[model samples]
Target: MDKNIKVGMADYKVASGEEVLITLGLGSCVGVIIYDSSKKIAGMAHIMLPSSLEIKNNSNKMKFADTCIDLMMDELLKLKVSKTSLKAKIAGGAQMFSVSLNTESLNIGKRNVIAVKEKLKSLNIPIIAEDVLGNHGRTIKFDCNNQQLNIKSIGKGEHII
Candidate 1:
């Protein structure tokens, strides 16, 4: 049986083998899934913002793409998963509201996606798949056993990456 782990908004979770990780209601937020097929280790992060530097809160590292990915990498390393073997699948980062059309700060989804990609590149983690940048929200499920990322949206239905 697969153990389902729920990753909340601005949070992250790690799993191995047949475990499944899920996150929901991603609008301007992004869901990042990392997996090592050989080790059967997987992690999912729900990032609400692009950078931690922009905010002074200093709380909730998972709320920022840069810090969130770093935290997840540390956990994966602790679990004995090789960094070189890690691959990523990202979803969400949608432009949910029309008011965010041209505004930089309000267009958080685009910023989140850019920051995520930059962070992943810096960490040498290749993003193998992604479903991003639209006008709707998303919910995602990451299967550790097969490294399959299942993405679902209200009007978009479902897609596997």
Candidate 2:
């Protein structure tokens, strides 16, 4: 039987075999899924911020994209998963509210997405697919067995990436 592992906001989880990683309520937050398909190993991070460097109270490493991905990579490496074989699939980072200001600082969703991509590139993990930058929140689940990311959004329905 497959176990459903929940990755909460500002948190991360790693799994292998038949385990599935899931995260919910990703509004202005990004759900990053990194996996080694050959080993059936996967990690999911629900990142609330782009970088931990910009925040003073940055104790939680999983709260930021840069730190979270690094930590997840370390975990995967310990599991005998090679960095070269890792691939990523991301969802969420939605612009949930309308903002009159055109300032980039207010667009946390876009910033989160950008930070995630940058971190993944720095690690040489190519992103296989992504569903990001929209006005709807998302709930995501990553299946380790088949290496599929299932994304669900309100009124937007659900789809696999």
Candidate 3:
């Protein structure tokens, strides 16, 4: 049987073979998935912020896009997964709140999405698919067996990306 590894908010988890990585309640947060298909290795990070530099006492590295991805890559590299073999998939980053003023600072979700993309690009990881930016929260399951990310949202049903 395959093990299901649950990743929480501001957290991350890595798995291999038949294991599946899952995360829930992704409102304004983003679920960043990175995997090496040939090795059947995968990881998921539920990032709550765009950058760690934006806040004081940001000790939780997993909560930000930049730090979280760097840490996850280190783990993957340790597992003998080459950076060249890595691919990515992302979900969540929803605009959950309705604000009267249309300002970039208020759109944390969009900021997160952009940051994730920038970080991935810096590391030369290609995002194969993504489901992001809506007014709803998301729950995601990353299956290591086939490198597929299954995303579920309220009133949006379920789909694999």
Candidate 4:
């Protein structure tokens, strides 16, 4: 919802039409959320890592992008939300790397973005919109009722889709 809502690291929230979910400070992490207007369904996640393989014991599912998205989808299904009609949007992934000026393009943020896209592709989920890659952070808000996404860079305008 909109009243001082807060989603900490590796956290997600779901609600219906009456609520608005938002998250900020997405750099190498991704905000993968889905909205289904007809079903009045919505879900959001903040994925801090790129894959589950890094965790050999199936630990901390929310930390990995793939597992995080799956977690969101799994919960949405429990609400009777069908994946066939689900629409996904992703944001965040900046060159948060300080490796070297020559490696500015090798930020983990870009890797995270690519990982999310690959995961979605494997799941047959289409990305309706995205605002990824750069040397900055991102803030995202999803209005579930209307399936609208509001994306904003730190000092730029909020983009609506």
lDDT, candidate 3, 65-150, per-residue tens: 98999998899899999779899999999999899996889999999999999999999999999998989999999999988898
lDDT of 2 by residue, 1-161 (tens): 64999999999999998999999999999999999999999999999999999999999998999898999888889999977899999998888999999899999999999999999999889999999999999999999999999999999999999
TM-score of 1: 0.96
Off by over 4 Å in 1: none
CA lDDT for candidate 2:
0.94
Candidate 4 has an lDDT of 0.79
- Superposed Cα RMSD, model 1: 1.3
List model 1 lDDT by residue over 23-79, tens digit each. 999999999998899999999999999999999996888899989999999998999
TM-scores, one per candidate:
0.96, 0.97, 0.97, 0.87
Candidate 4 — worst ten consecutive residues by lDDT sum? 1-10
Candidate 3 accuracy as lDDT: 0.94
Report residue 67 deviation for candidate 4 (angstroms).
1.2
lDDT of 4 by residue, 10-56 (tens): 88888787677788888888888776768878888888878788668
Q: Candidate 2: misplaced stretches above 4 Å?
A: none
Error of 2 at 20 (Å): 0.8
Candidate 2 TM-score over all chains jointly: 0.97
Per-residue error for 37 in candidate 4, Å, reads: 2.6
